[model samples]
Structure formats: structure tokens, C-alpha cells
Target: MKSITRYLVINISIWALLAALSAGVILTSLFRTSAEDAFDGQLDMVLKMLVGELATQLFSSEELSRPGSLGQPRFELPLSGWYWTVSRSNKDELVFASLSLGGENLTVESQSEKQYTGGIGRYLMGKGPDGKRIRILEREISFGPDQSYYFRVTGNAAELDEQIRSFENRAWLLMVLFGVVLLTASLLLVRTALRPLTKLQRRVRDVAIGKSEAIVGSYPVEVDGLVEEANILISSNKETLERARTQLGNLAHALKTPLSVITNEVRSSDLQNADMLVQQVDVMRDQIQLYLDRARFAARHNTIGTVTKADPVLKKLTGVMSKIHPEKMVDYECSADSDICFRGEEQDLEEMIGNLVDNACKWASSRVVVSLTEGLEEAAVKRPQKKNANVRKWLSIIVEDDGPGISEGKIDEALKRGKRLDESKPGSGLGLSIVTEIANLYQGTFSLERASLGGLRAELVLPAIKEE
Candidate 1:
């Protein structure tokens, strides 16, 4: 998937998870509240039943002075899980109290109607009993006129806590399952939505690998734009390839026609002048063919992956010059902060630098200095015109000669194809032209100016190639 669409899927999935978790927590809390209220209601009914039975038994009893009667539970059936204590007061004093003992005794401060029924509410608290923490549910119970008789009921809160804990655990488990289901559903949705894009990708790959000429399927509107762009690029590249091929074919055909004419003319000439004339014609043919070959080399593929390293070029050139002209001195200097490179064909880079260095060697009296720096100057040369900030990361090579330089106004024409300043100089003018084209393809710059050493200085500024 494209970056934006992938992010959208991930973001939606995350929000869905958070929402699911929030809902799970709220629902779990609500379930626990409902369960607690139902359990509390049951507990209140049990307490009310016990209070009613105890009031009836106490009013009919003839053993009111006995402590055993006070300790006896009135209703045994409803008090299955309940604990209780009863106390009697005479003249605002505890005249009688129950013998049931456990954690703490509930104290009654006053006689009021509020103490008779649901006087005090239950709350959670922990009490230390026998060096152990005991969670208890406590409430005060009052009976009879003047509310002098009081009862306190306490129950273990462990069962209620367990119920809440179990509910929370189950809720979390369900939430996790829901989240997984939601994530799986989201991924399926993303996949189904991107199926058309995947088909487009496969078609484009087929075209790239030369398995097909173009995209081969109907696509969605969202994907139509990308398909159209791909088709345009492929068409443009094919046109360029065809044009280059045609130009080469025409150049060959033109040269062959001239060769055929020369052969015919040689056969018609007298034997005396035939050999010299044929030799001259052969030389012309060779020169024409050489220029054509250079032209083909100059028509480089713009997307060719080539990286030019200055140090390697300098090393190769210096090594060659040291072997060929051992008696002559050559010095290589570089002021570049780092290695300067360019994204162009390696053969083209070799030819460009080789031509400049070879020309420098011919003109240098004793020393030929090659310097590499990285920076931009104002655009002067028209062939490889500089444009874009990306070109500023350029490799500028300055080849200086100590010997006499080119005459004024000749440097401009030297770069033009087949324009040689000196006929006596044993070289084709195709070198600079090839270099200019290579630089132009990468949007680099080239210039020929007078060196401070009173000799010709050739400057080649090419865009830097970033190392992977």
C-alpha cells in the first residue's frame, strides 16, 4: 500500500481498539454495580426477616432475664450466612448484651426511629482480627419502643469482591477477543479496498520486465491516474530509443553510400593515381566512421547508473602519464572537502577526463596540475547548462597546463562537434562534445578558461553522486 493509505488503516485500527476498551470498562463497571445492588437487596430482606422474628419471640418470652435467650437467633432459616448481636437497655444503660463475639461490636449512640429500619448504610472497610485483614459489611439494627433494644449485623464481603473480580476478568477477556476480531476485519477491508492497486502494480511490473507493452486491465478511478502516468513515461522512453536507433541507422547508411561512390570512382580512375586516391578516400571513410561512433557514444542513456570518483580517475591518469611520460613531471591536487562524484556513464566520464588530461599533457611544458573542488560558479558554457539546486553538489575538476594555452576566441569553438582549432593536433574534436552531452544529461556544467599557470584550464562541474 502507499504510505498514506497504510497510515490510515493503522490509525483507524488503533482508534477502534481504544473505543472498544473504553466501552468494555464502562459496561463492566455497570454490571458490577447492578450485581452489588441485587446482592444488597437480598441481604436487606434477610435482615428484615430476622428482625421481625426476633421481635415476636422477645414479646412472647417468659425468660427475658436470661442471657441465653438474648444470644439465641430468632430466625435460623434466613440467617444462613448472616451474623448478628442483640442488646437491651434499661434507663439509658446496657442492662443486657449478647454473647456472640467476633471482630467488633456495633455501638448504638442513641434511641431514634432512624435506628429501627435501615438507619445506617453499608460501606467497605477492613478490620484487623486475629492479625488478619477481614473485609466486613456492617449495619445497625434496632427494635421495640424507645429503640432501646439494638442489633448489629456483619457479613464477610469476600464473596461480593470475588464476583466483581470475576466480572472484570471476563470483561477484559471479551474485550481482547473483540479487538482481535476488529483488527482482522479492518485488515480484510484494507486488502479488499487495495485489490485494484495491487492489480495495477502487477501490470506495471510486467511492463517494466518487458513481459508486456502496457498495462492490461480495467482499474478504479483512484488508480487510473497512476496507470496513465506510467503509460506516458513508457511511451516517452520508447520514442527516445526509436529516435536514437533511427539516427544511427541513417548515419551508417550515409557513410556506406559515400564509400560506394568512392569505390566506383577509384575503379574508373587511371592506375597511376588509383592507389593514392583510394588511400585518401579510405582515410576520409575512417574519420567519418570514427565521428559517427563518437556520436553514438555521446547519445548516452540518461538513466544509466554510473558514479564518477575523482580520486580513481586521477590515480588512473597519473599512473598512465607516469608510465608514458616518465621524464615529464605531473602533480595532482584536490581541494574538495570530500570525494566529488557524478551520476553518469563510467565510459563517458573516462573519455571526458581523459581528453582534458591528454590535452593538458600536450601543452604542459614540465608540470600538469589537476585539481578537484566542489562548488558552483555562474553559468557560462551553453552546452551543459547548470540548473536546479541539486546541481550545486558538483564535482569541479580543473586541469591546468604550464605550457602555452589556446589562442583567444578558440576555446568556445573547441567544444563544438568536429571543430578543431589545430589541424596539426592529432585528435578529434568529438571528445569535448561527448563530454558536453554527458554533462547535459545530468544537468552538469563545463567551461574552458585560462589557468593562473599561463596555460589552458579545463573545468568540468558535474552533479555529485550520493553513495547508497
Candidate 2:
């Protein structure tokens, strides 16, 4: 699944793009309208000025064949796309024209009375003498009888088009720049807004890895309730597991006492069935012990903030093993990294390491070796120099002895619960089995192999806490 930050960023970016597009469209439209309006205003002024000039000539009885200049140089240049015309309304004949027309006429449409205002003129889009698009403004006026004329002024539509196109280009560029700024600001805002959540996530990881006991730090009011609830949930789960472990211990004690009594009673009896009853009782006791061990491991395996240093645990276990097997004349060798720690309950670590070291002591003729090291599988095999905390690492606890090691075929059988080989040896065959079960509960691995010491090698790989 995608993270919340990515989901929110994508959604916000999409909306921002949509809003920018909408703004661009609106701005482009307004720019075009304003450009056209400015063009029409220029044509209106020219048309009114031409009408006043023509009226002055008519009232003064001046026989002017051409209209005077309207103070715009383009009007005097031929095919310059700026032109004016004065024509008789009755005969539809051109009476006067600007020099810029170059002897070609401007196309004028017939206008209705309602189309023209009393003082204001009518504006239109039309073709000029040079066949270019143009804006035209026309007005009709009368000085006397047989003196009515239409005055029309036109400007090139291309200029207005160029101006609008230039405005659109700049407008779009600005909008794109604005969009980029907006998106950058939004991303920064999102990161800042979610910083508290990121802190919460790191604290939760710390709790899981036994670096801290509970969630800590101030959070936003919006997520403060969630933080409190998570702390409550952690406390509740710990309490529940503690209660369950206590109940399981009580149950195991209660059952074992009665089972022990039954076993003793059967042993004292002389009947033929008594031996069979004793055997069955012993089997029941073994089964109870196995299951009780499993129950304890299962209850404590996932407890948060539980850490055990391997050096102290290994030292203590090896010391106990040395005392237990003093007559074996075993020379015990033990070494462990002080910084290495197990991310689990201390008793569980004791149980697993104790079983392996005890088994090595039991079988060793003269020497037993126990070693603890932190390693990644890939690094252990190939690159031992590089260390990556994000990669999975294991705490390898290896016990090797100089006694007779089992063949590869029987190693699997040896790990099975209650499957004792060489019954002459005083053991219920649950040692390796219990170690295997605890390793499995911790999401670890166990293997048996030929030892460097010329006997059995029992190796355990359990999850290790990464160094900060």
C-alpha cells in the first residue's frame, strides 16, 4: 500500500494542476476581450474624427477630393492595414478614402437604424483592401440636403491577434511558474505537517526493538488521542500477557504434582500393568513439560522492550554447565561480544542457550566450546567488512563438543521432541527439541553439523538488535 504522504501529495498536486488550468483559461479569455476592446476604441475615435473633418468641409463648401490626415502615420502608408472611407449613403459611391487603402475598397455591411446609436457608432469585424482581417467602426452624419455620408474607420485585426497571442504566452508562462511554486510549497507543507507522525512511527519501532518502554513525545492535538490510545493498548497487552503467564505457571505446577504422585504410586506397585502405567505416566509428564515450555515461550516471545545481553547470559550458562559436568574433565571455552543483545525475554534466551550448552557438555569427552557472534548471512559468507542495520542480522550461538556426533540422517530425529537415541544416556531427549521450539518462536533457525572440534556442532541463529 502507498504511504499517506504520497497519497496526499498526489491528490493535492492533481487539484492544484486543475485549478491552474482553470485560471489560465479564464485569464486568456479576459486578455483577448480586453485587447479587442482597445482595438475597437481606437477605431471609434478615428471614425468620429473623420466625420468631424468631413462635416467641416461640407459646411464650408470646400471641394476637398481626399480626406485630411487623422494624425496616424499608418493611415498615409499604402496597404498599411489602417484605412478610412467617406461614401454617399444614397448613391453608395465612395466620396473620399485614405491613401493607405491603395485604391481598394473596404467591405461594409448594410446596417439597420437600430444598429447605430444617436452619438456612438457601430463596430464590426471585416476584411480590409489587402484581404487581411480588420476591425471597423462606422457612423452616418448629415450636414445639409444631398450631403449625407457614411464615415468608416478600420484597423488590422492581425495586430490585435498578435497582442493577444503575446499576452497568452506570458500568462501561461506565469501560471506554470506559479504552479511549480505552489507544488513545492505544498510538498514542504506536507512534510512539516506529518513530522509528528514520523516521530511516532520511530518511537513505535524503538518500543518493538526494546530500545524504549513506551511511546514518548508531544504530538498534534489531532493525533494526541491516538497516541494515548496506543500507549493504553500496549499497557493492556503487557498486563494480559503477565496474567496469562502467571496462570500457566500455576497450572503447570498443579498438574506436575499429581502426575509425580501417580508415577511414584505405579513404581511401588508390583502388578504387570504397573510398569506400563509408569511408562505412560512418564510420557504424560514429558508431554506436559514440553507443552508448558511452549506456552511460556509463546506468551513471552512477542513482549515489547525485552532485551538480554548475550555475554552475561552465556557466561552464566557456561559457569553452570562447568559445575554440572565437573567429572567429565571438560575444558569449557566461551566467548561472546559484549555489545551483542537478543531482542527477546531474558528467560527465553537462558532457556535456549542453556539447553544447547548443556547438551554439548553432556556429550563432550574433554572440551566444549560456546561462541556468540553477530552476523548477517550474506556478510558471514562473503563480505564481512560491510555492516547494514536495515538488513536482517542474527545472533549466532554455536556450541561444539569433541564427543561422537550423530550422522546427518539422525540429526533431524534428534531435534524432534521426546525422541531419544542411545537410551543408556540419562535424558528425556527434550533438550535439543526445546531449543529448536524456542528458536522457531523467535523466528530463528537451528542446525546440527560436524564440529570443528571433531564432534557435534549445534548452531542457533536468533534475531539480534541492531546497534544505533
Q: Which candidate tops lDDT?
A: 2
Worst 10 residues of 2 by lDDT: 378-387
Instruction: Give all candidates' CA lDDT scores.
Output: 0.63, 0.82
List ranges where model 1 is wrong by over 4 Å. 1-6, 58-82, 88-144, 188-192, 228-425, 439-468
TM-score of candidate 1 to 2 decimals: 0.48
> What are the candidates' C-alpha RMSDs?
11.3, 5.6
Question: Residue 380 error for model 2, in Å?
Answer: 13
Q: Candidate 1, residues 164-250: lDDT per residue as tens digits? A: 899889889989888888888888888888889878877865653345787878888888888888787777766775688688879
Candidate 2 residue lDDT tens string, 84-126: 9888875379888898898889875544243434375677677
What is the alpha-carbon lDDT of model 2 when measured against the actual structure? 0.82
Clashing pairs for model 1 are none
Clashes of 2: 0
TM per candidate comes to 0.48, 0.77
Of candidate 1, the 10-residue stretch with the lowest lDDT total is 107-116
